[model samples]
Target: MAFRCQRDSYAREFTTSVVACCPAELQTDAGGKKEVLRGFHVVLEDTLLFPEGGGQPDDRGTINDIPVLRVTRRGAQADHFTQTPLSPGSQVQVQVDWERRFDHMQQHSGQHLITAVADHLFGLKTTSWELGRLRSIIELDSPSVTAEQVAAIEQSVNEKIRNRLPVTVRELSLDDPEVEQVRGRGLPDDHAGPIRVITIEGVDSNMCCGTHVSNLSDLQVIKILGTEKGKKNKTNLMFLAGNRVLKWMERSHGTEKALTTLLKCGAEEHVEAVKKLQNSIKLLQKEEPSLLQFHSLTSTWISCLFPLSRKEGDSEFMNIIANEIGSEETLLLLTVGDEKGAGLFLLSGPAEAVETLGPRVAEILEGKGAGKKGRFQGKATKMSRRAEVQALLQDYVSTQSAEE
Candidate 1:
């Protein structure tokens, strides 16, 4: 058996390494101007940077005081893009941001755990995978899986995370028996070179090009957000892991607290209280027509007992209330509050007639509004001049009578 160099494949195992320096220069492209060249791109080197490939984002960090913006693969070689120019033949110390790296590892490993469980439990294969900022999505080869199945998969993956199964990375030739014995998805057969296989002991072994955590325990939890139908025979799944799950929980708890306070109820009573409040609102709405009698009586009493002079705001409110009372050919003018600002509405006739006069009324009110089928609906914010709105309404009524 011929031994190939394990340096590049094993770079992820080490936290630090040395990289070659290359010159960087600024250049313009189709989009516009940009800072192009700052650091040297290493042509051939053993580095821990996972280059952007296979639907995974590239790792980012500083290398020897120079910020490494991106890592990309050109054929079999990994290229590091940096912010500062590096001298030719200069040795640069590299440090991978372990937090970011480990996060990727957790997510990547969590993907394997869930995918393996899905395949074992439901015979559904993961066709594609994507790691996002807050969540990851996996496309399954099956058309649909029941909610129970998804829950089971989630539970199983969490169980595996608790088990802390060792994640082993092995390199082998395409024709090796060890590779053939693996029961998971294989990489493209036409590619020439060593094949990288990530094996989750006693669980799964799949050909992959992404870096992952060393143990399943590193993934604190795998929470499935949801699943939806994809293509004809595929389903897409969204999930969160580790710190992301914690963050989600924090936000959820905060929202619950706010809702509880706003609703004036305890956390446990919130759901029932909301249901009761909704029912009460519905019942009140049903009784609103009857309530109009009292409102009309009150308006008349206020008009007679107080002042005939109406504020624009009160006039607007009376008009709307009168319209809601199913009145037609009735004039409502009432004023409330001070002169600086007030609310007003002008309604005449039944719901239908009010609607017919809506456009003209809106013009008079200097406001925009819409009504159901045939009801006038509008409001005036400033009531400094209530007489203007009343005059407009009277003119609109006169125009309608003439048009008829």
Candidate 2:
């Protein structure tokens, strides 16, 4: 516990004896799902690697140049999962990735400062937090946090960081009287033995298991990007600290520059420019429907009077045809379909001929329809029957013409 509470954020290199090495231990798939990993897990006698716990990710490093693929804790043991197993009796040099470890320290410590300040200033409690790879998040108990409020909190957080307050780690016995007075959510239910708490001098103290920098100055800076609605009236604040803030700013500026060039406008004018472009597109779409039509061509069916077999059209097209062929002994069969699904069918001609053959043609085509006067229209699920229906219509017309 004393070694862990030391001020150093990085243990560059250390020699440790392997307590045990399992050739094959049943572990779960690393894909964050429930599946057997077949054989995985390594236990070292003593180590400085911090496994994934307390919302802070695991420390990734090398054990004698062999990559520590993953690290997870089972009870108090920090299991160093690796592909190359070191024998139990062998001693190997271990190295923790200081860059990654230090980043997490910044994020974890930044969260502590922000949470404490938020509670003190606005009465908003920190219910939960996440140390994300790209940016960290702190979930507040309030349902809403306005931009101005967040700005206020952000300003205070940086002010505390600029103060360069000392961050101290302490180990207190379970019976310690000061443990209850610590400003935090509370201790874990199963927590036992000495409690590990992080105290920011003159600011806040939190019961935490994650590593942190020795001073608030090590945080460099904390920037609150935005807020999102969380479960049960919670507002999650997205933020970045240390070098991450600079990297995020770099990326955002690059994107804005590109958008300005492409939109042919200043960064401040991008929104209005985009809105105008969208309105132009909407107007073009409104004009396209009237231009698409199924022009008619004559065929050998019925003097092509009503012109059988016209191109596909919508209900408006059918209306246009109906109005144009008024009171004429015209024969027109209209069919329309798209992407080869069900089709629409229409046959209009002399009242006697249409009334006589429309229903029969529909039955032959395996379609559903009704005829009134000299027009018939219906829906056909099996459009492949179009040819057969046409042939039957021609045959019926021939038979009727012969009798007449």
Candidate whose lDDT is highest: 2
Regions more than 4 Å wrong, model 1: 1-40, 183-192, 273-404
Candidate 1 on 1-404: residue-level lDDT in tens? 11111223223333333446566543535467564555567543456667765556777666666667777666666677765655545565666666677777778878888888998998988888899977899999987888999899999998888888888878788779888777555554434467778899899987777777778877888899989889878899999988888889999899899988877788898887677666545544654665656466656632211112333223333434444443444434334444566454444444555566566656654556566644455565555655665676567556665676
Q: lDDT of all predictions, in order shown?
A: 0.66, 0.75
Where model 2 places Cα greater than 4 Å from the true spot, the runs are 2-7, 24-39, 189-192, 290-404
Cα displacement (angstroms), candidate 2, residue 58, comes to 1.1
Error of 1 at 311 (Å): 31
Relative to the unseen true structure, what is the C-alpha lDDT of residue 160 in candidate 2, on a scale of 0 to 100?
86
149: Cα error in model 2, Å: 1.4
lDDT of 2: 0.75
> Ten-residue segment with the worst summed lDDT in candidate 2?
290-299
Q: How many backbone clashes does candidate 1 have?
A: 12
**Compared with the true structure, what per-residue lDDT tens digits does model 2 show for residues 1-404?**
42331335556778878888775544555567766443447787766678776789988888888888678766556678887777888898888888888899999999999998888888989988999989999999999999988999999999988899999988787788998887666665655457778999988988777889899999999999999999999999999999898889899999999999887789999898777666545543443343222122232333333323333444335534554543334566666664246767778877887887788767765778987878888876766667777777667656666776
